[model samples]
Target: MSLGDDHGYGDSARTDASGEYGGTGTTRTRLPESGPYGGARRGRSSSRSLVTVVGVVVLLIAAIAFANRGDGDSGGAPDTADKPDTAPTAASGTDPVKSSTAGVPTGYSQSEQGAQSAATNYAVALGSTGMFRKADRHALLDALFTRDAAARLKGPMDQAYSTGFLDSMGLDENGDPPEGSTFVSRVSPMGTTVEEYTDTTAKVAVWYVGLIGMSGERSTDPVTSTWKTWTFDLSWTDGDWKIVEDAQTDGPAPVPGDDRAATSDEISKAIEEYGGFTYAR
Candidate 1:
């Protein structure tokens, strides 16, 4: 295929239909929610990388549990005040961190510690490798966010995963690489602060850096980029850090440093070799 073969999602579906996640070949499974599921799902961004912060709807949807995310530096935040110029990571938790993730709270609590833990974990889930998989997308969405928001967000996501977009990353149709590539997408939370909170309503921001691209392959966009600190104005909803509405501006972006780029083999191996974690505030 030529470099600019217009593989954009506007083109036809090239379902690799293979039996892998990040490997070559398209694959589709008949979920219980199958049939005519796709046509309606076409409008969402369809991005398999870290889901981009799409819009403001996330604000209302994620407001259920912000009450306990702890307040800002002085202990609580006034949602309307001019926020800090920038937020750095936090010190260790002074409060307890308990989370009952899915039936099992898993020790998640509702204090500054709890909020931090929740934010960290949610950020990881929100910024995971699963965002790319069609089969796993809904589950991750349902798990981390409110159902209402998930419903509306899905279609836009599908569209975002257009063929041209995937090709741009040197992948075939299903957001995967040939035999020797590693598509890497990860989000590391530098720290988080609850800008505002009131019982069932709260606003939290997670500042982070994400890594996206084919680590080592025939890719022009190496699996390397340093975006500005990403902030999520998340809400506490349906028992999780559901991002109701969020926005991002450029960095506390660090100056370009002297870290050597990993070789394609190193990147691919690392992608497969390294495991991801569920972050908490």
Candidate 2:
């Protein structure tokens, strides 16, 4: 069966016809009423990642649960009292940091521009396929989050991305798809805006488009794209911006396009050839 959303860790529900991992499940399961992620099931048309902030990241929906821990500024955020209604589209000309930590961009300036850059990069990292794997996920958390936040989340996040969950998404214990299939999960940032800013803390929102699903002739889950707004509450810590906590919501998505879907081979080739960029203000 095919899953939806590009958050990549996997979140779709369907009872298997043959009671196997990749079985042809005809009986569609439904999400629980208690919470958004509890047994949650979403249609193909759902606009964004399926996770909620209250608790539990059941698949593509991961809300890092670092509550009230970051942001030392006590002045309180004003309701855009002195800020512009919208940010300009022009480039800031300041170059992005050339250094990297655990393959993530690092060394951001302690400014509004730096916060935006941190948020954008963090969004991409969180929405990637690596979040599905054990070692990679830990490394990513280390690079993207504050020390305390990452330590608190590692155990819970591990539980959320369990072996059963991986099987449901047609991925092995290593977070790999079938032998011949290519699992595609990527996030491309559209733009960013600062919701609130301070010397020690900042809230930034990133509008992005994501691709998820498996690409192969034998694959049932062909790659599909979705739009989302991922907002991060960042704290300037350890010489750079680090995530305290984050949440995601459905877009501000534009109208659907009329273009035809590309083949699995084509999609695989394109992904292999076209590398992503290091985003900055």
Candidate 3:
């Protein structure tokens, strides 16, 4: 996926696939009131029913008693002797970066958690409204990318955010929406993964849902959502993680839900009122 496909941040020539971001009835069987098996079978069935009811009651009582036990004072805690040493997954409990460079998060730790955090934050920055503006976009790239990468990408990135491209998205040549219209290009990362990592370099992926387009009564390009996975190759340099390369792929998008599309007014109001998050793994 190109950045333009989600945020209008990349070359518009590379249009990605716009695929359609592609119940139980219970029945009860009743026992026969009468059958050829006779009254003896009926008596046995009644006994079995009584036994099942009694067993259920006993189990319920036992469960309640177990739940009410003391917390290991009298050896009443649940048996955890065979529990595994490591958790299958867990959070690192690190707070997101409180400081940023040119509005991009910086100063991540040297751990896997930090790598994931950096990747997620980079995805958000690369997919933000600032990326559509020349000066702000250059600043963002300089702050988030390594020096070499930024130099190599400067010309291409400028070309990608061209005036013609901005015009196609209902924006003026400067990447600003017309008066009374709101241009929305925001990325919210759902989760992050460190696909590969080392002390000096790491490859991370962030799965995210993005909102893009112009929101206004007169807007032809209404705001819409796209799901994508953004992967970044990062290097630990100058005591911070900086992106060396970045790429995006069309999602593992979920089936569309039944919710009605919100009105332009509602969309504009929501964007204005709700702030974005400082994401962490």
Name the better of 2 and 3 by TM-score: 2
Q: Provide the lowest-lDDT 10-residue window in model 2.
A: 27-36
Query: In order, how many clashes per candidate?
Result: 49, 1, 0
Q: Identify the leading candidate in terms of TM-score.
A: 2
Those runs of model 2 whose alpha carbons end farther than 4 Å from true positions after fitting are 1-84
Cα RMSD to the true fold for all candidates: 15.1, 15.1, 17.9
Output the worst ten-in-a-row residue range by lDDT, candidate 1: 1-10
User: Which regions of candidate 1 deviate over 4 angstroms?
Assistant: 1-108
Taking the tens digit of each residue's C-alpha lDDT, what string does model 3 give over 1-281?
12444333322222111110000111111111111000210112235556678779999999999999775587656688987543224456678576889977788888778888888888778677886788887898688877766655556556555676668767688878899999887888878777789999998878888777778999987777777777777889998898766656667776554456899999999999998866665
Please say which candidate is ahead in TM-score: 1 or 2.
2
lDDT of 2 by residue, 195-229 (tens): 99999999898898777777889887667777767
Regions of candidate 3 where Cα sits further than 4 Å from its true position: 6-91
Q: Alpha carbon lDDT of residue 230, candidate 3?
A: 72
TM-score of candidate 1 to 2 decimals: 0.60
Residue by residue across 21-96, what tens digits does model 1's lDDT show?
1112222111111111111211233443323343244654566446456555765555867756544454554433
TM-score of each: 0.60, 0.72, 0.71
- Best prediction by lDDT: 2
Which residue pairs in candidate 2 have backbone atoms (N, alpha carbon, C) closer than 3 angstroms, thus clashing? 51-61
